[model samples]
Target: MPNSTSILSPIDVERIRKEFPILHQQVNGRDLVYFDNAATSQKPAYVIQALTDYYQGYNANIHRGIHTLAERATKAYEATRLTAQQFINAASEQEIIFTRGVTESINLVASSYGRAFLREGDEIILSGLEHHSNIVPWQMVAAEKKAILKIIPVTDEGELDLDGYKKLLTSKTKIIAVNHASNSLGTINPVKEIIQLAHQLGAVVLIDGAQAGAHLPIDVQKMDCDFYCLSSHKMYGPTGTGILYGKKELLEKMPPYQGGGEMIKEVTFEKTTYNDLPYKFEAGTPNIADVIAFKFAMDFITELGKENIAAHEHDLLLYATQQILKLPAVKLVGTATQKVSVLSFRVEGIHHFDIGQMLDARGIAVRTGHHCTQPLMDRYGIEGTVRASFSVYNTKAEIDQLIEGLERIINFMK
Candidate 1:
């Protein structure tokens, strides 16, 4: 067992746990142990309340109406954008563009920026550890433009090959796209160093921050990344909402992602002029209600302090890692020195899907399969692994339940 003193401090964890009503439930006649946070974090009551209050109290379409409800709605929606700006430390509110999720955000960049700038033989670099959302959009752009797609290799421990990454960078390199943390394996990539190197080569960098928004600190200005993407669902907010952060200069240069009601400043049958920054990319009626509620989620993290939440999750990761490693039939994957509380592993002779189902039977939730990183699994010579991810509301006792369940499963399989 990890030293409790070093691994954990109260940090008012019990009170924090109570804030998430979903954690107080039962599954399969046992207390629920939610270890699948990497998929989407459970919403806290405050965030839920915000959603309810919006629908009941002030539900209205924003930006065009002069009515009181519309003005209030617009104010609340844009306030969340400002909150998102502060959350990621972007230089200005104009840098943030709302989207359905990280997938849409990346596709927006791949379409708008790549179509505008990339040419034949120009290279866009990605990593072996990327989710399918990050990989597929770039592939589409690369194929359309005849641009070359290069990969930064993944090591056995799931860390990116930085030396290899340096080798891949050249004058022809136009973009470098990588995740801040791997959703499947939880490896925190050295995005700052990656950005600096890409800039030196005159290539733009995009950090897919879907996993990091909830667990790590982000400062796009300090990191000097050209583009960054975040998912509200992963960060304890509502589903179907996220943001894309781009440097103002880059955004201004790129073409509009979609043509619709709001993104246009002036329109004619022959010609249309697009709106200003942020609005240029947000084409349709935005996810107003969810966007408004997302502020409460960001506030929840800000008030709790990311560092404090990280320490708590780190404790859970260390404890879980230590306990899992002691199982004779089990083998851990992605042993990166730095990670956010995700543990992926496999037991000998037991399929990952079977393990997930068995754990679910015991009222412990976990994710299994490729986790949308099929290439990473291939790199490890496996089909997939059982992944148990942690959040702020998770406890050491929950981890203990997972361990007890896993041990029984392993014994039974033997």
Candidate 2:
């Protein structure tokens, strides 16, 4: 549970800073300034230690094991599911299905629920700002089911065109999928409104929360979304571990996502009865250690409180934006009023790749390019932009270094 604290309470930045060991290191003879939080966050010492403890102590397969070590491992692994349930305010642990990441989570839904529920000529709506993970899965499923794929357009400010979305919704719409926050633009979509609208059109909604999971406070029930996906790596946990939350009734109707040991109740040449809610989606041996360690990552966020973390990151965003905007050649991308800590931009007369490379030489890491939102890049008529995303561990001092580096790059290029 999150501590009872004021949202504006000052964060113990130094204490929190100590939790992340990687932040103390140096790169290229300069202090490492990690601004690639949109890609993946640096894991805290507790999370790292948790991973070490799991492998060093109870390195065993989870579930269906009778030994003491197995029981301990299973207990820890299942505990993460409970933590995840609480983290998202989910109805029950049964509603949470573990996967490799958001990509796999979306793919699972596209292959299973999509195959079962969608029919020929049924339409699946995606937004123009969707990551390839959200787009590709729907495309694959739509093609397989002979369904139509529709898109919700974006405005110049990078906000979703709700009017366009409303026009696209119809009786033929079976699924409406969109990201909670744009990875490239940091545009926060009105998912609750979108979900309600989709429900009115008799369509299910899936929110790709890959970017929003760590930064936003999410409640599946409040949002009324049929499905929500999260990537643990983006949230300061290990890679290759994520979650898919689906409504119980909807999950019960969908078939198992994969065929393997734990997903089965009874197996025979004649037929195989599938296991219950979560196990139905989790096939084969799962990433036990990482899943077990993810609880610490969740705990880290809970301890800080999501609102406090968001407020601090918001300060960083505003400061960075104000500083970057003063630069003569810098052009800010994604001017949406509602956004997370992502600040994407491009400098005049300088390629994004060149900016990124020069920044890397100064030990500042920022992502460059389309950020897996090719459609969005196409919409903006730019090849790519340099993206500097923030996390709870980041500081304004680092942003100062970033600004300095960008200024140097711009002047040198000019």
Could you say which candidate leads in TM-score? 2
lDDT by residue (tens digit), candidate 1, 132-244 = 99999999999999999999999888899999999999899999999999999999999999999999988999999999999998999999999999999999999999999
Residue 66 lDDT in candidate 2: 96
lDDT of each prediction vs. the true structure? Answer: 0.93, 0.93
lDDT of 2 by residue, 1-414 (tens): 224466668677777778889989889989999999999999988899999999999988988989988999999999999999999999989999999989999999999999999999999999999999999999999999999999999999999999999999999999999999999999999999999999998899999999998899999889989999999999989999999999999999999888999999999999999998789888999999999988888887877888988898899999999999999989998999999999999999999999999999999999999999999999989999999999988889999999999989888877
> Stretches of candidate 2 above 4 Å error?
1-6
Clashing pairs in 2: none
Query: What TM-score would you give candidate 1 relative to the actual structure?
Result: 0.97
